[model samples]
Target chain A: MAELIFTEDPEDPRLDDFRDLSTADRRPDRPGGRGLVIAEGTVVVERMLASRYPVRALLGVERRVRDLDLSGVDAPAYVTSAETMASVVGFHLNRGVLAVADRPAPPVVSEIIAGAQVLAVLEGVGDHENLGSIFRNASALGVDGVLLGPGCSDPLYRRSVRVSMGHVLRVPFAPLDGWPEGLNLLRESGFTVAALTPRPGSVPLRGLREKVGERVALMLGAEGPGLTAEAITAADLAVRIEMVAGVDSLNVATAAAVAFHEVAATR
Target chain B: MAELIFTEDPEDPRLDDFRDLSTADRRPDRPGGRGLVIAEGTVVVERMLASRYPVRALLGVERRVRDLDLSGVDAPAYVTSAETMASVVGFHLNRGVLAVADRPAPPVVSEIIAGAQVLAVLEGVGDHENLGSIFRNASALGVDGVLLGPGCSDPLYRRSVRVSMGHVLRVPFAPLDGWPEGLNLLRESGFTVAALTPRPGSVPLRGLREKVGERVALMLGAEGPGLTAEAITAADLAVRIEMVAGVDSLNVATAAAVAFHEVAATR
Candidate 1:
């Protein structure tokens, strides 16, 4: 069982990881200058406890701490007054509980792709909310993993984690360094890379299942600026969600969800 | 051609329709105390210009005003610096433009459902973002119309207009007054009302396509407290989007998008 510790001091040095969370995503002093993996709210804290990332500590109000199941956890859990907790975290957290964990080494792109039947590859999804929503969709649709190409945001960012409903911690994703050239790696691994775009000539999304049945990689880009010319050209085929005339393209995350369901079910 | 007036003062009386917008949604002195319909950004403002709502005026940066094709619009257009516009709107206007219009009379529920092949009926979807997302999904997937049940947020709220990418103006929606009892009205109109839930006995979403070939009304509820028991009981069938084990349900709007594609596909 995890050990429970009581702390009252807002300036306690032991609570350094829980400080000024509004700007916590950038930590110059930490390795790689990235913030620790933080999970807020009981549901997300429970997800962190189940994930592979090693939890370092927890800070929460007494009621929240009492609500958690700590049977197998070995980390220290700190219980404090909401006021002191708010002071320590630099803002009032409505979720009432937080868990901090170190970043685990990311899986290799090949390793994630190798065991997956369905995969989502994202490029230029710089917005954190879109990245998080994609993860949430990927998890729901049973996509095996995600590959992040250039211009993608950090999935471990606090906003991304929260928006993903903590699925970012559970879903395995690795950055693909090379641009459209690296897409060849997925093709070599027996995955058919289908670039999702709204271009005029692309086939509708429903036909993709008939085109690629086994290992499938659905490549998507940001909303307004869809897949780049090079990215679309490199894919085995281009697919699109047929939309109403004169309507703007669907939001990137919502579009991914639709495509994820379409391809994942076929496999 | 529409008249364009340049203004420097942030507190001009002509711009009153766009002032302190963060709290402008509530207007007891207005026609129905339901506030003016507000559209933000160039895309939504353009939609409002074409919608039935009477355009009161427009406040925007000079660049955004020039981008709009307002040949037929007669409302006064105020061109100002971003700073001045931000002060008038109560926050920084990232979209650079905003249009306020008097709310048009809502269509009757029967009028919206007349001759519809597929429909989305929402209950307790009071969050502006979720409501907007639902509208966007409804438009993209070709749902014929939306029926707002009790506790639904106003679809014409400014945030909904922007987040929906201006689709709210194009999609028709009206209130369903009789609650769960009123759902029978849809059945009377040759519709199969399927309640979307994750319950054990619910039919898979894909199966819904085979069961109902005629007019279908897909019923959805808020995220946490899914369709109320009364609502579910009123539904002709209970449907579910099959999700991964141990994962929470998809976001209400995302789920609706997936289900809409499944139920509305004619081919």
Candidate 2:
């Protein structure tokens, strides 16, 4: 079980990990200059406890901490007044609870591809909210894992964690280095890479399930400039959600959800 | 063509309609204490110029105003520097354009329903962003119109206009008065009112496409507390998106997109 510590001072040294979260995504001391994994609200905090990321500590109101089932947790959980937490964090957090976690060693791409029936490979999904939404869709639709290509934001970022409803922790993700070249690995693993684009030449999304039912590594890009030319070339086939003419393309996350449902439904 | 009149003063009374947008949604002068239809960004501004809403005025940078194909537009198109625009609106205008339009008389609920093939009926979707996204999805998926049930936010609000990518201007919408009682009017119009719920007893969404073709009206509620008991009971059928176990429901707009795609596919 976790140990509960009470603190009143906002400047307490032990609370440094939970400080100034608005700019927490950039950490000078960290290897990649990225912040520690942060889980907010009770639901996300519960997910963090179940994830592989090592929990560093927790800070929350008394009621929130008492609500958590702390068995097997070895970290110190701090109980602080809401005002003190707001003072320490530099913002008023209404989530009432938060958990700070250390980043774990990333899973191997091969491991994710090996066990997956359906996978979502994202490229240029730089927006944290979009990346988070994709992970949420990927989790709910039974996409086995996610392969993050270049230009993708950190799924463990606090905003991403919150937007994803903490599913980023529950879903296994591994970075796929080397841009389009890394996509070759999935093809070799008996996976058919289906690149999602609204291009005229691409097959409709509904038809994709019939074309590649064995295994699919569904690729998606950011909303505006969709899958890069080279990325499209890497995929086995290009698929698009057939949409009305003249209307703006669907939001990247919403489009991914629609496509994910189509692919997952038949599988 | 739009005549661009340059303005240097931030306190110009002519720009009051575009001032302090954060609080502009509530207007004491307008009916129901709601603000005039406001559009932000060049795309949405152009859409407003083409909509039925009477253009009141426009505030934008020179480049943004020049980009709009404003032929036949009679509104005062004020050209201002970004700094002046920021001072007037209480924030930096990243998109560098704004347009205010008088709210047009909404179509009658029966009129909106009479000519519609596929329609979205929303209840308790009070979030401006979600409301806008639904409009965007409905337009792209070829839904003929939208019926605002109880507790829906105004789609003409600025945030909704921006989030909808201006599609709210093109698609028609009207309020469905008298709660679930008005739902009977939909059945009278030869419509299959399908309520979207995650309830265990609800039929899967895919099956509903085959069951109700051509004239289907999909009803959706807000994210957490889904369709109310009264609303679900009013529908012809309750349909559900088959999500993986243990995961909470998708965002309201996202679930709407999935339902939209299903209906579109059938059409």
Model 1 misplaced regions, further than 4 Å: A265-267, B265-267
lDDT of 2 by residue, B1-267 (tens): 567789999999989998999899899987888898888998888888888889999999999888888889988899999999999999997999999988888988888888898999999999999999999999988898999988998998888988998899999999998899999888988999999998879898865777985689999999999889999999999998988888888999999999999886436
Each candidate's interface RMSD, rounded to one decimal? 2.0, 1.9
- lDDT per residue (tens digit) for residues A189-266 in model 2: 888999999887988886567788578899999989989999999898998888888778899999989988888753
Q: Which run of 10 residues does model 2 chain B get worst, by summed lDDT?
A: B205-214
Kindly list the per-residue Cα lDDT of model 1 for residues A26-51, writing each as its tens digit. Answer: 99999999999999999999999999
Q: What lDDT does each candidate get?
A: 0.89, 0.90
Model 1's TM-score against the true structure: 0.97
**CAPRI tier for the interface of model 2:** medium
TM-score, candidate 1, first chain: 0.98
Scored against the true structure, residue B261 in model 2 reaches a CA lDDT of: 90
